[model samples]
Target: MTRGLSRRALLGGTVGGLALTTALTGPAATTATAATAATAATKTAGAGSRRGAVGPEPYVPVAVGAGGGPAGTDRVHVLKIGPDTAHTVLVLVPGMFGAAGDFRLLARDLVAAVPGVQVWAFDRREENLADRTGFATPDPAGYYLDGHYRSQDPTAAAYTAGWGLARTLDDLDTVVRMAACGGRRRVVLGGHSWGATTAMTYAAWDFDGRPGYRDLAALVVVDGGVRGAFKGTGQPVSDSPEQVRERLAAIDGGAVFDMTLSGVGLGSRAESTQIWYQLAGWYAHHDPAGRSVLQPRLPDALRPSSPLTNAGLLGTLVDVGFGWPNDISVHSGHLADADADGVRGWVDTGITPMSRVAAAYAGGPQPAVWEWYWPSRLSVDLDVADPYVDTDLARSLGLRLWHAEALDTPLYAFQTSYAKGTIVSGARDVVTNSRIPYGTYETDNGMTHLDPLFADTPHNTLTRTLAPFLTALR
Candidate 1:
């Protein structure tokens, strides 16, 4: 999965000098009015307010997999922002290896812009003690174990079995219902990168002969539409089926894929860290107040002006798959814009020395100081099947998740010109194969994959793109 800064300094000198921010124009004002009216009617119809008149609502951890029995280990955290009387909630899921914290900026922007619409960032249950410590495999420090499912050893099992595709879909189903607050609200489902895949899959899933996400009003996909990557053609997405099979085996076998530096033979956490620290440092130098915006989510030591030799902070990034080499990069078949000069400049600067990186690793903890960052087990499974499911000789190309007859939800895609293939192919497949009305919006801001989560301007692009679509929903 692919995964942005300041109020003035941040927005002023964006990468391409494009002002993605939009003023509250005629259409936007109309959309806000419609949203306000919709929420007012909900209040009149007798839905109690969950948020009292106050500051931003605090995030409430909702026990997901455990149902209503006991406080379960598998929990989905929800942060609600806006008028409590609102009946429409946009539930946004984070991309793989990304937590709910990633969507904080986007959620805040949406609530401030839309009059009555509330935004809930759904943090899927992911932390697995087993996977983080490398207990799932013989090698305790293997970076390949970064995104696998948790183990079910009776001695080590925290709650239930590790998650898979079926379970992830079920989890989203649970989150959707929870967001609905007893069916009083209409839910909009959206996600970025691999999170987009989860959203699309949930939209197409069949639950007891009905659409699993029956409450969903719309789908928003950002920079990812690979669910239908192989649609409408019998051609193999890879050059050869053998290649697909080989890659699948490697992914399942815990082979790490180096994505940071181009052709540098850097394939492990230590090697990658030496490069990432330089980037983080460089990014910090260029953006003065970026640390203020990022401090809430990023580790303290990684913040700008910190001593450049903080091994512990760098180690955390490796454990979470940011700099650490993992199978996900290879599995997704996209380097997530690491090839860009913005990403590569850190390594090109040659500031992070191998000696320092080695000393940092050696001085670090024995078990690699495992951070509580584990992706859904089912996500890894999907990576293995992406080649076949995204495309197929017999099914032509596209997703094999659900029958087209079952899809009737409205779909919207926000794509970049760089990855036009994903958006175009996915939209084509959804419209041609299903009854879902689809639309596509694009930007040429020349941002890397993770910019939307970090940049304020891109959110402006999102606002302009979604105004008409949301107004129509009213």
Candidate 2:
């Protein structure tokens, strides 16, 4: 089932039964200075762990320009993981609404598993616009309360009207070039989910008459792709020119960013959906066992029969078998005490641990995992570009997928249970369409979409598979 660009499909519907009638007040807010201090402290503490070899420092933030656009609007942020001395660099692009921090755990494991390798997780230009005020405080409640009551939803940046795939590709090219270091090092480009589509799109993209695959030694796709036999809940293949034009016009009319969830009333309010996700994440990470303030606010259908802990609340929202659709569940199991009449807690029945999921959302030295101001224009362009099918309409929209038959890069793709065989089939399509000489595809039907990245196992499928693939390139 190739998914359309409906907001519900994109966001997996709203967190069940979230209805906020009033915003609760928080303690005195911390300043940006506090955020910087917190970040420095986090860097010193070093939250991520490496197994065999000493990896690169975590959360090293780097900024580069997309080559053109408004002065500050073109800036792209990257979180560097692994040692700088490593000669092999894997540039990882995040999925939609995802940030560099989404790859935090996976990057650490990859660097340790594969010697002489580093990972540079890419964050889109929009990440620069997120307000870090809530992240400045160490207290989870403080973070939650601040975002809930005080967060501001600024008007969408006018420049964002033009932040489509063309500009995004330009920004990615800059990062790839920097990581390549004038051909001194080997570079592999990879992405997860929508980012996987992005990597595939980039491989076939035309940059000033040059094919994008020439810049990379290999390609890696994690749980997403553009073409497949299954067509199960992935990106749409195309959009009508008239529809594209209407979307563009809407962007030009100041609807440049997506700030609301489609179905929920509270989420429809400016900034509420973003704030709720962040707060829930922080609460799950910092105070998993603590009583949740958010639970009482949820409608009975979504809320536990009894009070829930912070972790339980998050689990209820995201775990499979909790009445949520399987596509939206990041993990395989529900929280412990979920059915009990008292406070709920966590159980380790899933590939991704609740703590790790929380950390991804809670964030660290880098920006939060979720993008608060996802550019609406990128979706419009991606609908036309993701399939790697070139057309006159695509050319008109500056979406260049003209080099599908010319791509020569080796590909390795892994699929989680959420996508089943779709991702691997998509990889096959790329190899077949391009007549590419080399490709590898694997599927872990036991894991969720996020399991490859956040699974708390020593034998992570993604890590083991990707480590060997990248090491072979050496």
Name the candidate that leads on TM-score: 2
TM-score of candidate 1 versus the correct structure, residues matched by position: 0.56
Please list the residue runs of candidate 2 whose C-alpha ends up more than 4 Å from where it truly belongs after superposition. Answer: 1-63, 66-71, 138-156, 228-230, 234-238, 259-266, 269-271, 297-301, 338-341
lDDT of 2 at 89: 94
What tens-digit string does per-residue lDDT give for candidate 2 at 1-474? 012234564343444323210110111122222223223323322343323225344554445555344455556777787889889999999876777877877888887778899899998887766666656666544555444434334353576777788888888998898999999988899998778878878888888987899999999988877765226655344478788888888778788775434333335543455556667777777666667867776544345555566766776666654534444456634444332234445554556666666776777625666676677788788777656788898889888888888888889999877655777887898898885779988877777666776776464788878888898888
Worst 10 residues of 1 by lDDT: 327-336
Please give, for residues 1-474, the per-residue lDDT of candidate 1 as tens digits. Answer: 332011232122221112111111112212223223223323421221221133465667766664221235566666666677777788877665455554654565566566667877666654323233222234322332233434333223322233455656677787788778898888889887657767777776666566654678887777655444423222213424565456445444543221222222222332233223333222222221122222233323333222112221222232212332221111110001111121211110111222122222221111121113333234344453343233362122122455444566787777543353565566556656667766555653443344454333233466556655655665
What local lDDT score does residue 271 receive in model 1, on the 0 to 100 scale? 26
How many backbone clashes does every candidate have? 11, 4
Query: Model 1: how far is 275 from its true place, Å?
Result: 14
Candidates in order, TM-scores: namely 0.56, 0.83
